[model samples]
Target: MATIFTIPGSLRSGSSNHNILKFLGTLVPDGINYTIYDSLATIPPFDPGLDNDTTPQPVAELHRLITNADAIIICTPEYAFGVPGQLKNALDWLVSSGTLVDKPVALITASSSGEYAHPSLLRTLGALSANVIEEACLLVPFIRARIQDGVLDDELKEQLESAFESLLKAL
Candidate 1:
């Protein structure tokens, strides 16, 4: 089975980005395994000095998850017109590890106006040598309006399924 690691780049409990990721998890096709890495909040701030064989527990765990996954999907919200600090910090920890090198990645920027973080996230993932599938990457603007009562609308669901299909094909 193909294993997909999902990262929701928001710490807020009720974030629309997080909700969308949750929705995507439920739509995984047969023969595919989907897991959401829900430990971003527990990860310590990135520090080059600490990026070594003796990495912190949380960082090591994150590394392990990424290393074992067949593909990755990241759904994030733009913060202050840029990538969120927490998500950026998590990516920073992977820079030297090579865990993401050539890994197939799907990026979804979900927010009111996600243009800024969408490109910024792509640049960062590219720098890490990840093979980001362009067709799978999406900028979902006004995301809050698309979700109601914890469920994504049919149209958004179809978009997510298309992105997920593209990601699987790239894998």
Candidate 2:
């Protein structure tokens, strides 16, 4: 079975990013193990000193999940015109571990104006040497308008479906 892991950049309970991940889960085919990681808030701040084998349990678990997954989907909302703090911290933990290196990853930046954070995250992922699927990368501005009552608009849904299909094909 193909293992697919998803990460939501926001810690907010009703986050659009989390909702997007949930929607993505439904697009997975049978026999694929899909998981939406909900522990971004639990991961402590990045410390180069603690990046060894004895890392924190949450960070270690995240590393293991990414290392084992066939592909990863990250849906995030920009904060303060930049990547969310918690999400960036989580990526920081993965840098030394090299867990994302060569991993098939799809990035979705959904926010009021995801312009800044979308490309910012792309650069960060590039630094990690992640094999990001260009066709799977999406930037959805005014995201709140694209989703209503947890339902994505037709255009957004179609775009997400196409991006997800691209990621699945890369696996």
Candidate 3:
């Protein structure tokens, strides 16, 4: 079975991005294990000086999870025309650790105007040497409007399903 580690950029409970990730979990095909990494808030700010073997417990846990996963899906919201600080920090922590190198990743920017963060996130992941699947990377603009009461409309659901299928194929 393939394991997918999903990371939502928002820290707020019931956020659109988080809810979307949860929805995707339900759409996973048989033999695929989907898990959401809900500890972004628990991870302390990245500190290069303390990035050695004795890193923070949360950081270590994050690394372990990503390392164990067969693939990764990052669903994020744009914050002030950029990636969320917490999510960026998590990536920063992985820079020197080589945890994401050559790892299959699918980037989904789900926001009001996801355009800004989409390219920026791709560049960041590229710098980390992640095997970003271009076909699977998607910009889900106006995501809040596409989902209501934790449910996605048919159009959005179809789009997300296509992206998910591309990710699985890439893996």
Candidate 4:
């Protein structure tokens, strides 16, 4: 069974990004072991000072989690018209560790139509040496309206299912 590492870019508990991740969790089919990084809020701001041998335990755990995962799925919401600070901070921690190098990753965005923020994320992920599967980018427009209680609307659900399949194949 493949291990799926889910990263919700939002730190807010009820954020749309988190909700999207929950929706994807339900889409994980049989034989797939999955886990979501629920400690984004606990991650401190990335700093060279703290990147040494004795960093906080939570930061070390986060690095270990990403390094051990088979594949990564990121569900993010745009903040200030760009990637959220928490998500960027998480990636910053990985920049010096090479944890995501050559890793198969899928970036999903939950935003209104015509409001996607993936190109920037894609560029950043590529710069970090991630093998981002282009076909696995899932954009759920009007996400709040389309997915309720972690259940996607019929059309979005189908798209998410297909995206999940594509991600698994990318691995």
Candidate 5:
């Protein structure tokens, strides 16, 4: 069975970014398993002192989750026109652990205006050597307004489902 690990880049409780993840869970059709990593809050800051030694338990667990997954879906929310520090920290941890290297990844962001962070994040992911599936990316502006009650608008639901299905095919 193919498995996909989805990371919601926003730490906001009940954030639309996370709501999209929940929607994705329901959309995971037969023949594919989608797992949501809901422990982002437990991951500690990246510290070199913990690098090779027994790292923070949560960090190790997160690494294992990504390392075992067939692909990754990252949904971020831009903060100050750039990536959130928490998400960047998580990626930094993955970089040192080599968990994301060569993994097929889809980078997405929820925005109120435009894809302000996508370009920077795309470049950063490229530098990390992740096999990012650019075609699978999406920049959803005014996501909260566009998605109603945890469901995407009629027009966007099909698009999101198709994007996910495409990522599944790649996996």
Candidate 6:
């Protein structure tokens, strides 16, 4: 079975990012193992010195997961008009490791006026050499209100569903 991993950029419980992941999980078809990485908080600061054969346990674990997954989905909300610090830190650890290099990734910037963060994150992913699927990426502005509507709104639901399906196709 194919495996797909999701990483929510927000650390807050019940965050719109997490909820988005949960909603996507429901759309996972059979013969696919969908997993959500919920340990972003555990990823320590990016220390180039510490990133080696004896890397931090949390960083190693995250690396292992990303390496094993067939594809990656990163859904995040911008903070102070930029990518969240923790999420950026996590990506930093992967820079030297090249864990995301050539990996199929789908990015979703779901926030109020996500314009700034969305492009910034795309650049970061590009720097990682990640194969970010263009069709799979989305910038969802005013995401909280959309999440509240949830499955009720056919258009938004279809859009989110299409993003996930696009990722699956990329794999």
lDDT of each: 0.92, 0.94, 0.92, 0.82, 0.83, 0.90
The top-ranked prediction according to TM-score is 2
Using lDDT, rank the candidates from best to worst: 2, 1, 3, 6, 5, 4
Model 3 vs. true fold: TM: 0.97
Candidate 3 C-alpha lDDT tens digits along 108-167: 999999788999999999999999988888898888888898888998888888888899
Q: For candidate 4, list the clashing residue pairs, or say none.
A: none
Alpha-carbon deviation at 116 in model 6, angstroms? 1.0
Misplaced by over 4 Å in model 5 are none
Please give, for residues 58-148, the per-residue lDDT of candidate 2 as tens digits: 9999989999999999999999999999999999999988999999999999999999999999999999999999999999999989889
Off by over 4 Å in 4: 113-116
Cα-lDDT of candidate 3: 0.92
Per-candidate Cα RMSD to the true structure, in Å, reads 1.0, 0.7, 0.9, 1.8, 1.5, 1.3
lDDT of 5 by residue, 33-111 (tens): 8887888878889888887767889888988998889999998889898888888888877777788889999887886
TM-scores across all candidates? Answer: 0.96, 0.98, 0.97, 0.91, 0.92, 0.96
Top-lDDT structure, candidate number: 2
Q: lDDT per residue, candidate 4, 6-72, as tens digits? A: 9998777678777667777887878988898899888888897888787778889988988888999
Relative to the true structure, candidate 2 reaches a TM of: 0.98
- RMSD (Cα, Å) of candidate 6? 1.3
Choose 2 or 5, whichever is better by TM-score. 2
Model 6, span 12-43: residue lDDT tens: 87788888888889999999999999899999
**lDDT digits (tens) for residues 104-164 of candidate 1:** 9999999989989999999999999999999899999998999997889999999999998
Total clashes, candidate 5? 0
Which residue segments of model 2 deviate by more than 4 Å? none
